[model samples]
Target chain A: MLSKKQARAFFLGGTVVTFLIFIGLTIFSLSKGQDQTNHEGITEQVVRGKVLWEENNCMGCHTILGEGAYYAPELTKVLDRRGEGYVKAVLMSPVPWNPNGRQMVAYGFTKEEADDLIAFFDWIGGIDLNGFDTVVSPLAKDKIERQTKN
Target chain B: MKYKSQKVAYWFFAFSMLLLVLQITYGFIMGFARIGFDGLHEFIPFNTARAVHTNLLVVWLLSGFMGAAYYIIPEEAQRELVSVKWAYVQLISLAVVGVAAVIGYHFNWWEGRKFLEIPRQLDYLVVVNVLLFLGLILATLFKGKRKTTTALVLTMGLLFAALLYLPGMLPFDSQVTDSFFRWWVVHLWVEGVWELIMGGILSFLLIKLTGVDREVIEKWLYVIVGLTFLSGILGTGHHYYYIGVNNIWLIVGGIFSALEPLAFLAMALFAVNMYRKGEKKHPNKIALFWTLGSAIVSFVGAGLLGFAHTLPQTNLYTHGTLVTAMHGHLAFWGAYAMIVLAIISYALPNMTGRKLYDSSVGRAAFWMANVGMIGMTVAFGVAGVAQVYLERKFKMDFMEVQAEISIHFVVLILCATLFTVGIIMYIMDFIKHGKPTDEELDLESDL
Candidate 1:
């Protein structure tokens, strides 16, 4: 077996390397990336849709931005995958669409409300989360407020 | 019972058991809700129930740790605790804060983060509560006759765990940034420093129960500490993989987290080896069983199962699915939960001068809980694999996929019921032990 000093040196070296990597990578996550781009172009309707999404706890069933429940499909890319018209139709009467499916608890949105959710989905889909660490910009400080107020 | 003040730990543990009951009750509430019971939907929605259940788990575990520290430190350091009055006050404050947060969750006054949903206003109180606990533990350890390695490692684990909570509290406007720091508290605590605490407690228990040499056990404690930090600190990257962090985590996390099992493997090996080497046997069979069980099962649950999803390739499909839930149920139960129960089982009879270790219910409690949790882990595993394939691989509709797996929740409830019964029997045994008495103080001493 190795001496005590060798064991200590090995342990110390490993701890330092691992800890530094963690600190360095955390900095990389916050500071870098195309995700730091502004949330500038989100329209009033889209923002209203964001508020609607939160108030309804769409996350209770569906994952938005990859952080919500896994019960339903991830809505982050739903607009692209399902298309706006189909998303609207599903949101319009979610229960009948999937009669024997997992419960979405029919919120019974009107066509306009469905359109708002689609717009919100469109806004989320445009962002480049690149299949993981879905970074939302801190620069979009007043974005939620602007939507709710509108 | 070596120290008069150590009796306060009994109250802390009793409080912890109360919270566990509430926690399981809420788990049932949600389990029923999952199967379309939904009677409590208006009052306690699934999300609210979820937050309460998880928060209670964290609180009770913290309480258990505090109780363990109180019981272990005084004996290890060869001194009575510095203050008994302040310790009781701290326990009450912890209970009050824990209860208030649970109530706050039902009213939707929470931050809506997964585990950090303690409503920031109350987080300040938790900080205060933890500081008071550290103050007492550190004072006792430093002021005592001998500062043992076991005591110091346990203290360090508790201290660092408190410090990690600050990152989660920082005002991060970005969700990605918020999640990055959140893992510091979650991953770092469970996979990182908490292993140190576990090692320290295991060392103490092995020394007492196995009749092993103190020097031999403490030496293993050092190796465990080294392995935990070597892998776990960087293993935080594992959670960072798909969470919108930098892509380097994919490699860094995959490599480092895969090595985390080594620390746990060492723990299992250490315990078994210590038992084999010890020629003299300790009479506390239940405590020894729990001690050895914690070491072995933690390897299987936290070590092997954790490794199962640690690699990027597997985690990509299993990230937030039932696979994560499966691992969570087992690792938490196997590692932290079992160790806490081991200490309590060891300490309760010694504390209250009641020797009930030979009872039938005690044996039943241990076996049923372990068996039920293992069954629950398997059910979650099957459901997780099914969900991953149907939704992720086959491109099936998400709702249709969930309906397909609703059957597993049925099995989950059945096993959870058994697990609950085991816990109840354990609590009843605790009650039977009565309160600590001065007559019992002569039963044991470390130095």
Candidate 2:
């Protein structure tokens, strides 16, 4: 039988402990990695891609920058995982996948739009701050112009 | 047995049970979709099933609680229900509107969020809730008793619930305002108004079941209600943190929501203390199970996990993740569902002239439900962490992210299955083995 004063003390003590833990964890996370920048003016493309993603409700299935629907893959580091050409090819192939039995239908895009999408992916795939491997695929400098220009 | 108030209560319980069955079945289908999307996509898409599951859960819990209030208030006030016929009218109207809204949702008519998607199918659901609110107000007013603090808090809760719904229907230009108003309805109702209702009901149960002085229980009720408004209203800030809102919401939401659990923890302590100090041996030990279970689970579910994500920093990671779902499932069930069960256990015997149910089976069911809920919460927490790691940390392929975290998903499915089994067993125990005796009937009038 804890008295009222004791109960109050217990709650206050527990809250302080919890608060400290949250702060400590956050600081720990922040201190873990160094920042890296591969693209200078790619913010616009990433922003455009984000708008397009929401318009199409892509986040309803896919996640990007750690947000959105969980049904699809994370797109933040896709550029690191798949190069610019593969990204463009996947976007423009009109046949997303041809697995053993299941097939992913293509949302057909023009060549220019596909390249822009790849540029957007490339932008996201380049964020590597905090030692977190947010990069999805590594981008080659030659392909960067082609992807961005498209 | 012959009392009209008791009959009305039973009918309300029955209706609530109907909705509960539908909600759980939808939940199962939603789980199956997660596991085998290709197999079940056409029959019941994930979005549709999720909408139905969450909506039905809210409706059923509210219905059961409304029914419990009708039964508890009349007895506490020591008067016949002011308008028995009006009560029946309110019940039937709310039930009809709720069912119509749910049916509308099934047919692809929804506003698109989980608990807020009551569709234009029967916009009258809002009207019905207001009517129910009026019914409660009128009943309390005409009963010729001073408004107890508990009743006052409950009435305030209902009023807020009704008022909150209006903004949801407003035409807003900015999605931010829309989202804010939506949380005002959804988050405030559950974490704020609903807590008030729980405090009132739990106090009422404590007085009746423990033979504790109303003064003691009512004092506890006042404290709980105070914490509720103080912490809960401001606690809405937690939801605002990530939704493109101003940064000030970060501090306000984090601090207040963090403190919100204190009220729940206090309520748990109150219950335990009352049970310790209780002089009379409660006739139905199972009633105590419902009572204690409601307190402990609500504290753990709503208070603890709620604190975890209340901070802006944590919310950034946990928002929209499985962690949110885990918090919701346990908190809502603990606050509303278990409270309703507690009230039902206390009143059902009196209403039906039944003796107490088999205590052992009731106790077993309680443990089963509690264990399964804890399991589900753990599974979802683990899954949520994995999700953040894959999406935020590793930036893994989307499908591969899900596949990697499939183990947590499987654990959650099993936990839900276990929870459903426990609920079914409890329901069966109520119907088949509940106590039926005149002595139990006299116990209510003795108070």
DockQ of candidates 1 onward, in order? Answer: 0.21, 0.07
Error in Å for residue B393 of model 1? 1.4
Q: Chain A TM-scores, all candidates?
A: 0.61, 0.53
Residues B1-447, model 2: lDDT tens digits: 323454567777777878887898887775655555445554455555666677788778877777776776665555567777777788888887787766765555566543566764465666665676567655654574566655655665666677767766764433334455777678778887778778878887787667787776776666676676667776777776654344556776788898999989988999988988889776877778888889988999899878877777766666656667778778877878899888877777677665655466677777787788788888878887787677555645445656667788678888988887788877776675344333433423544
Question: Candidates' lDDT values, in order?
Answer: 0.79, 0.66
Off by over 4 Å in 2: A1-150, B1-3, B433-444
Q: Please, what is the TM-score per model?
A: 0.88, 0.77
Judging by lDDT against the true structure, name the best candidate: 1
Candidate 1: tens digits of C-alpha lDDT, residues A83-104? 6777777788845344462344
Candidate 1's residue-wise lDDT over B44-112, tens digit each? 777777778888998888898899999999988889998989999999999899889888776766766
CAPRI classification of candidate 1 = incorrect
Clashing pairs in 1: A132-B244, A133-B243, A133-B244, A133-B245, A134-B244
- Looking at model 1, residue B312 earns an lDDT score of 86
